[model samples]
Target chain A: DVKVTQSSRYLVKRTGEKVFLECVQDMDHENMFWYRQDPGLGLRLIYFSYDVKMKEKGDIPEGYSVSREKKERFSLILESASTNQTSMYLCAARRMMNTEAFFGQGTRLTVV
Target chain B: GIQVEQSPPDLILQEGANSTLRCNFSDSVNNLQWFHQNPWGQLINLFYIPSGTKQNGRLSATTVATERYSLLYISSSQTTDSGVYFCAGRNQAGTALIFGKGTTLSVSS
Candidate 1:
């Protein structure tokens, strides 16, 4: 089974603070993604990486950035946390193209 | 990118009843998948069907790529089977899966 693990299950941060959410996958997938899920909006991609040090902006890539320094690790960074950024963040990984992506449990972020 | 739409945004069913979930995409796709998000918010993949049909346990899924639609069937449903069902599709040349809003299933005994 593919295991995707998040560094935190729940997090609360104050406004203007920096937030870092980490994700690690045991499957060594080549593609990793970051998405924020909201009610009625579904899951909107924030950023994705096809290989180490290579990143692409998804549909909703404002105030959010990602890092993929290694094949097994991906990180989501919130430049300046705000109330609008509070939402459930999900991390997923896929082997290459057209493969079923496995997701982590998710990180519920609350910005106050 | 593909536009994926799922039918019956919300569904309510009785235990032992069966239900079918539908997903429609706007364009050609190379990959399609079905997922179940439990009450606790854990997303689990049910099927990875680009086309044709695949069955696992009491659940089965069929994706007709030519028609740009997919169907998920749950037979003899249980209370524990209630949650959100999402269908995602990747365009013919794309790698990321564009997901539908999802259908929330509620099962009562």
Candidate 2:
């Protein structure tokens, strides 16, 4: 079975603090993505990494960046946490040419 | 660019009722799938129907690639079926799946 695991299930960070959201996948998938879910905005992509050390911005990439140091790991960084940035973060992994994708449980980030 | 749209932003169904959710993709996103987001925020995969029909228990899905649309049918809904339903698919680039706004469902017992 494919598994995508996020480092924290829930996180609370002070405003202006730098936050790190980690995602790791057991499957050796080449595509990893970070998305944020809000009440009515649905899920908006933050970043996508097609391969190690390669990344691309998505629909809502402001105030956020991503790093792909290894094939199994993708990290999302909040340069400065803000209340408006508080949302549910999800990580997903998919094969390069396949359409089936799997996601992690998600990390709920709250900035105060 | 690709766009995924869903109908009935919110739905309320009584137990044993039936419902159908629709998903439409603007581009040629032949690869389509449906997911159920549980209360705990975990996305549970429901069906991956590129084209054609598939059934599982009381749930079933049909995707028409040429028409760029898909439908999910729920039969005899239960309280446990209360949750958000999402449909996603990949564009021609095979990039990550573009998701729809999702249909929020509330099933009452």
Candidate 3:
């Protein structure tokens, strides 16, 4: 079974603190993505990486950064946790093409 | 870049009922697919029909690639089927997917 695992199922952070969300895929997929889900805005991509150390900004990249130092793992970083940054974070991975992408269970982050 | 639009943003149904959800996307976005986000916030890929149709148990999906549209049908709906359904169109580059706003479905006993 293909699996995408997130480090935490829930997180609470203080405002101005740094946060890190981790994702790992066992499928050996080359493409990995980070997305945030909000009540009315739906799911919006924040960042994605196609290969190790290669990253690209998505529609909602502000206030967020990502790292892909290894093929199976991708990490999302919150430079400074803010109230507006409180949202459910999801990580996904897929092959280059012709395959279905899979997502992690998600991390529900609360910024106080 | 691609833009996806979904209709009937919200829906309510009784158990054992049937319903359909629609999604439309802009040009050059293939790999049309559907996903279900359960109340627990886990997303599962429901279908990957770039074109034609596919069925899995009580759930089925169809995508018209040329028209850039897709439809998901639910048959014999149950409480477990209550969730947000999303449709996405993958960019030609295969780098990422552009998703529709999603339709929230509520099923009652």
Candidate 4:
């Protein structure tokens, strides 16, 4: 079974604070992604990494950045958290040629 | 980027009932998947049908790439099946999946 693990399940931060969400996968997948889920918007992609040191901006990449220094780990960074940034963040990983993606339990972020 | 849409934004059913969900995409796709997001917000992959039919237990899915659409069927629904169902598609660009708004399913005993 493939396992995708997020570093935190819940987080709270004050406005203008820096925040980091970490994800790790044990399956050695080549693609990793970050998405934010909202009530009516469904899941919108924030960022994705196809390989170590490679990153691409997704539909809603504003106010967020990503790091992929290693193949097994991907990190999402918020330059300065704002209340509007609060959301359910999800991390997923998939093999290069595989169509199915394995996701981690999401992190519910709260910005006050 | 491909546009994905799901039908019946919400659904309610009783135990042992059956339901079918549909997903329509705007362009040709290289990958398509169905996901069930449980109440606790854990996403479980139900199907990876780029263009074919697959089944598991009481659940099944069919995708027609030529038609740019897919369908998910759930039979004998149970209370534990209550949650959100999402269908996503990946276009020829090989980008991440573009998700639909999802169908919220409520099953009552």
Each model's lDDT comes to 0.92, 0.92, 0.90, 0.93
**Which candidate should be chosen as best, given lDDT against the real structure?**
4
All predictions: root-mean-square deviation over Cα? 0.8, 1.2, 1.2, 0.9
Docking class of 2: medium
Higher-ranked by TM-score: 1 or 3: 1
Which regions of candidate 4 deviate over 4 angstroms? none
Please write out the lDDT profile of model 4 over residues A49-104, one tens digit for every residue: 99999999998999999999999999999999999999999999988745588899
Docking class of 3: medium
Model 1: which residue pairs collide? none
Clashes of 2: 0
How close to the true structure is residue B2 of candidate 2, measured as C-alpha lDDT? 86
Off by over 4 Å in 2: none
Residue A52 shift from truth in candidate 3, angstroms: 0.9
Q: Determine which window of 10 residues in candidate 2 chain A has minimal summed lDDT.
A: A93-102
Tens digits of per-residue lDDT, candidate 2, A1-112, equal: 5899999999999999999999999989999999999997888888999999999998899999898989999999999999999999999988765667889999999999
Number of the top candidate by DockQ? Answer: 1
What fraction of the true interface does each of the listed models get right, in terms of native contacts kept?
0.74, 0.62, 0.59, 0.82
Q: Among the candidates, what TM-score does chain A have in each? A: 0.98, 0.97, 0.97, 0.97
Q: Taking the tens digit of each residue's C-alpha lDDT, what string does model 3 give over A1-112? A: 4799999999999999999999999988898999999988888999989899999999899999898989999999999999999999999998876567788999999999
Report the poorest 10 consecutive residues by lDDT, candidate 4 chain A.
Answer: A94-103
Docking class of 1: medium
Stretches of candidate 1 exceeding 4 Å from the true structure = none
